[model samples]
Target: MKMVLFLTVSFIIIGFVVVVSMKGKMERKLAFIQENADNHKNATTPIILWIVGTTFWGLVSMALIIGMFFMN
Candidate 1:
């Protein structure tokens, strides 16, 4: 039970960090693209990264919730 709690908290913290980092990264990329007219093609990478990061976070959260339910 303690291990499960530790893992859940760790993953949540990691997910939060990933989200904040990705948001900053995406903003920087977008700003760069805005400053340069020809860099529009690179915009998809940041968007994809943001989507993947959020999706992974959501999945982990759901999995943890389910695991906790079953543990009881």
Candidate 2:
């Protein structure tokens, strides 16, 4: 309906703006990464750990929310 169309249009517009604005910065960042490959090697484990922990916490929070809704 109208809500879906609004969300679709908003998503497309925001995505287009973000991409257009960041295209140059993205290319620059990629070039920097390609030039300095060793600097980011140590971050993989920590990033993975953070993602896993965050996912677990998010699921737990979502379950709690659902439980509360059902309990009420």
lDDT top scorer: 1
Model 2 global lDDT (CA atoms, 0 to 1):
0.58
Candidate 1 pairs with clashing backbones: none
The per-model lDDT (C-alpha) reads: 0.83, 0.58
In model 2, pairs of residues that clash are: none
**What TM-score does structure 1 among the candidates reach?**
0.74
Model 1, 1-72: lDDT tens digits are: 989989998998888887887788787877787788585886667678788879988898989978998998
TM-score for candidate 2, residues paired by index:
0.45
TM-score of each: 0.74, 0.45
Given candidate 1, what's the lDDT at residue 32? 80
Query: Which numbered prediction scores highest in TM-score against the true structure?
Result: 1
